[model samples]
Target: MTITTDKFNTEKAPKPVGLYPHARKVGNLLFLSGVGPRQAGTTKIPGVDLDEHGKIASYDIEAQCRSVFDNVRTILEASGASWMDLVDVTVFLTNMDDDFAIYNKVYAEYFADNQPCRTTVEINKLPTPIAIELKCIAALSE
Candidate 1:
């Protein structure tokens, strides 16, 4: 199988925290990193704040959720993939109950045509105060 990475210069996407690109394409699959709403080179999104050491942001759920997905879109474009190529997604939310509606609103935009299989769950924590993080598997060269 062949492998490649997708990178971009978008300020709207979060900077990688380690020795990794935002997404990597292997064979027909683009494996995406888990993403949050934090802007590139910053710890917080515009209207979000850290409540405690491990608490997630209690901001407008829709906006924050949308931001993370937007970052995903950029990464997909960089990988020569698109939302239409998504095959599966796994979402981790610190507040899934509170953010489900917002997630649905934004998720629908990308998943309208070929809805992928998905699973979401509320977790105890995520990186920074971002409410959610999403990891995806997408068709890369299809």
Candidate 2:
């Protein structure tokens, strides 16, 4: 069978920083790109304060995680999916040790019932100052 794909974008989510769409659908699966905390059409990142040199001066992991998940939700909805439809999520964090607990708490509030399979890992840096990002996939509703 030939597979067809479609790119998904929405104004409710932050504009992609590079040459990629927010998500893509191939048949029933929606694959989302890394979703971050930056607000749509603005440079503001919810959980981060930047220094003069654009470094993270202070950060709140919970805020960042919430924003990222909200952004992901936007894309998912735009792609005809929902949080409950999500089957897998891959999370990236710059400081996992210090941030995991808060992130997990906020995450539980969203996914406690639907509880998708998840994998989280520490990374050196992301494209922005935000502390967390999520790459997710969902099975599209029939």
Candidate 3:
């Protein structure tokens, strides 16, 4: 495999619906694709498994946000990396004003000391009306 292709592999991150890989690794760097609150294969948010009635059984922003982190972690693990390798991150939110606290709560749990360069922004819309999306870059070990 090419250097970039080997560093980041689509199979590592969540499946992309368009012309995008979950992440791409180039040399010693790993660039993760933007991740939202969706479950592995479905557009539905992670903590909410809807029934046939389309009614959500449970939906917590904190839970959903943590799930997003979990997805990121999965990608990192796939690339033989981890959150400690993260160098930069960008968070996109559909409703930042409403979800900031919940996002922070979940985020702090995962990023407490291994804080990577990060930014957050309020966007007009997200892929699935999920509260947040995260993309990151990580430096691989030599």
Candidate 4:
């Protein structure tokens, strides 16, 4: 059987920093690209303060967590999926030691109802100034 593939991008979500769609579907799985906390239609990143060098000075992981989750939900819905469809999630944090507990706490609030397989790792940095990003996979019910 031929494999069916489709890509999705939504204007309501933050425009991707690179040349890639927000999410892609191959068969029954929907894969989301790294979603960050940057708000749509603006450069403001929630809870991030930039130094004079345009680098991150201080960031509240809790705020980023909520914003990123909202972005992910936006992409999922735009792609005809829902938050409950997420089956696996991979989180990337620039500073795990300082942010893990806060991020985990905020994450629990959003994911209280849906328990998906999750993995979180500390990374050196991301392409943007945000502190966290999420790469997720969802199993569409349809």
Winner by lDDT: 4
lDDT of 3: 0.78
By lDDT, is 1 or 2 better? 2
**lDDT per prediction?**
0.75, 0.91, 0.78, 0.94
**Per-residue accuracy of model 3 over 1-142 as CA lDDT, tens digit each:** 6453663454434576567777787888888888876777656576665667765554577877888898899888887888899999999976677788888887888899899998999888665546678989999887
Residue 114 deviation, candidate 2, in Å?
0.8
- Give the deviation of candidate 2 from the true structure as CA RMSD: 0.9
How would the candidate models be sorted by lDDT, starting from the highest? 4, 2, 3, 1
Estimate candidate 1's alpha-carbon lDDT, on a 0 to 1 scale.
0.75
Per-prediction TM-score: 0.81, 0.97, 0.82, 0.97
Q: Is candidate 1 or candidate 4 better by lDDT?
A: 4
In terms of lDDT, the poorest run of 10 residues in model 3 is 4-13
Model 2, 1-142: lDDT tens per residue? Answer: 9999999999999999999999999999999999998999999999788999999999988888888888998899888888889999999999988998988899989998898999999999998887888999899865
How does candidate 3 fare on TM-score?
A: 0.82
lDDT of 1 by residue, 1-142 (tens): 5556444334546787667777776667888888777776676674475566745335777777777877778777776788888889898887777778878877887578878899998898875677778898898565
Q: What TM value does model 4 have?
A: 0.97
Tell me each candidate's RMSD, in Å, in order.
Answer: 3.0, 0.9, 3.5, 0.8
Model 4 worst lDDT window (10 residues): 55-64
The per-candidate count of clashes, in order, stands at 0, 0, 2, 0
